[model samples]
Target chain A: MPENMTHVPYYPGCTLKSKALGYERSAMDCARSLGFEMHEIEKWNCCGASFPLTKDNLMGLTAPTNILIETEQHCKERDIDAKLITLCSFCYNTLKRTDFAFREEPGKLKTLNEFLNREYKGNVTVIHYLEYLRDVIGFDNLSKMVKTDLSHLRVAPYYGCLLLKPQKELGLDDPEEPVILHDFLDALGCQVIDFPGQVDCCGAYLIMRNPDKVLELSHNILEEASEYGAQTIVTACPLCQSNLDQSEAVRGEMPILYFTQLLAVALGLETEQHQFESHCIDPKSLISSCKKFKEFSDAK
Target chain B: MQINTENNQAAIRDLEIATGETISDCYQCGKCTAGCPASMDPSPSLLIHLLKLGLFTKAVNSASIWDCMACLTCSERCPKNVSPAAIIEGLKRIHLNNMEPEINLNSLGQEFLAHSTQQAVVSGFRKFV
Candidate 1:
């Protein structure tokens, strides 16, 4: 399993490249430290977080389908058999659901492909970063690659809404009580805290118009995490991270860290620490105080 | 509260066709309303009830329609498999279609628009438009 990954295909959904650059950087660095190279698709576009739920909304499928088509073509040209891994949960859900639509409704896929004047056989398999860690990379190798054990940090793993929903199909972990993140954190030598708000919505896309409501939801989540005695909240979705971190309600008391940021810390990967400057609730102070930081320093 | 079943028949049919969920099967169990994280006044169950009763106009303008985060928790928790989020999306789409001519792209101020991250603008327009 250790040698399974040499060069892998990565899909940096729009938010990752723009708003969540820290997540993308940390994830790529961590992957390299674990003996893998993450090669992003040469040309990519946004996987509109707003997936068209209606039957006739073919236009809504274009951006995601185009990304899939391009990624598949790249893989084909290179003869690489890698699954397209996504950093954003929103992108993961949209791309995965689009792929599902192509598989389940071949007629729609054919029609869309024809409309775009391109034929995609739906060859690309899309996955979230967490799945890449749990299934593809394997936790044993992950633990072995950790240069600094983070057993002293207590983290609340938030799954948000998209990662696990429409439970019957998505092939994501259990929608009700997913433990994939908890297990991943445990393997990274962190004490994972369980909270009810772990799977609650951060009111995605509502942050603009309904700041009050988004703040209320964010407050509820952070309140639960704080009550559970979690020093920080770790999440997979970029929007979720931004929403939770940017909410003024928390007043900079809680630090929201992307799951990969913690991975970067545990692996002692040298990264630009200023990547955290954009976070509303600063994670630098809490992250620097972790037991791993001491171990990292002693080793240095 | 007025039921305009005769006038809104086409709207109801369009909703059913669009969402692909059986709106009439909801027996008012309130599971969707109960499980929704962002559920507020004019709850998800009430929105579905408006659809079931053929009150498209009321359903379309309901604040709860926008309040729905489209989390799909209600869809998973529904006993009869009624997807409230999908139904809300359909309602929003209907509203958008009715306002299509007036939805001038230039009318959306650039400065006001710039405040939102790409996630919001893309998701907001994708669902509504």
Candidate 2:
């Protein structure tokens, strides 16, 4: 638990802190296991995700700007150099695109700077934890460091739209179907399946005005998942997990689990610390079959 | 400006608005929810979860909307024919409208520019779809 060992800034967006608590925990453990430390950016606000309801680009730009300023101030105060590691897919996409906007168009960055009245120094690199996991920490190293390998389970790697959508910023894989999740799952020794609904949305934000609609989309993904022979769906995004797991409560029975939940089990982590059952989706039947691997108790 | 919940919800009825039929078929079974991956979120369980909490606003303006693969997995499994994927698409459109054309390394926008690939013959999927 060294606080100064090649520390990076970990930005656990709203979902990570609340709904996706499992993701945050696994991410922290994963980072530490890799011998790295993450200092959270102080008092961060929402990234004006999706959109600000104004239908304007500038408003959208402003959301990330708020975050950028906050991150900059933190960096300045600490006098430490580290790129920002984002846990949420949406957050990663937002920060990466914002940073790219600044770098690609310095003039726009300057205009933005005038609004802030501070010098726009290239302070931090906003990167997705997956990228950090793969690039900053090598795949071979990750494979070697795995205290738990989910070699027995069959998983469908759901990319969801945000992560793989804007292909360029995501740059993780193919536009129609990506392989990053599949690769990560494979690294964990889970038998990854190529499914049809691989790139679909989890009906996340839509849970508000349209429960019926969420049902339709979610049902579609699950039906296809069954067709694909996926016993469980694994996602890196907490929102994705929320839509995939919780959506079933209103609907019926679909087996959806977070990637971290399985990873935690594989890592021999205690169920109480990870709390796999707290998820709206029941992982019982899915992990019940996992008995062949190791002893799993639902203490949480 | 009037919040006509019934009419608005009815308008987007039966998953597909163009159908214009009230999908009176729904029995309120959790079948659709059970089959969905996006339903992994809490709000997806109860349509009310979206409204009661402030989650609805975030959903429409969410990167999560764009995250939908539109595999129709939920639609296919729904006993009531909910088509949560379509609603997600509708919300995603809202996000897309407000979306800044992130010309960064992750944008898939450029993929639509050409109708042709290496040995190719095709327009952007948006046009054909």
* Best candidate (score: lDDT): 1
What ranges in model 1 sit over 4 Å off? A1-5, A248-250, A291-299, B1-6, B100-115
Could you give the interface RMSD of each candidate, to one decimal?
A: 1.9, 15.3
TM-score against truth, every candidate: 0.92, 0.65
Q: What tens digits encode model 1's per-residue C-alpha lDDT throughout A1-300?
A: 256667778889777777788888999888877777789999888887867777678888998999999888889988987479888888888889898998989998999899999877888888887888888789987887777768888899999988998766578799989998998898888999999999999888876557788888888888889899898999988888878887733555788888999888888777574287778877778777755546556878
Report fnat in order of the candidates: 0.72, 0.01
Candidate 1 Cα lDDT to native: 0.81
The DockQ-based CAPRI class assigned to model 2 is: incorrect
- Per-residue lDDT of A24-123 in model 2, one digit per residue for the tens? 7876766676678777888687774542211123445666777777787787787876478887767776777777667776776787778767655666
lDDT of each: 0.81, 0.59
Instruction: Provide DockQ values for all models, in the order shown.
Output: 0.64, 0.03
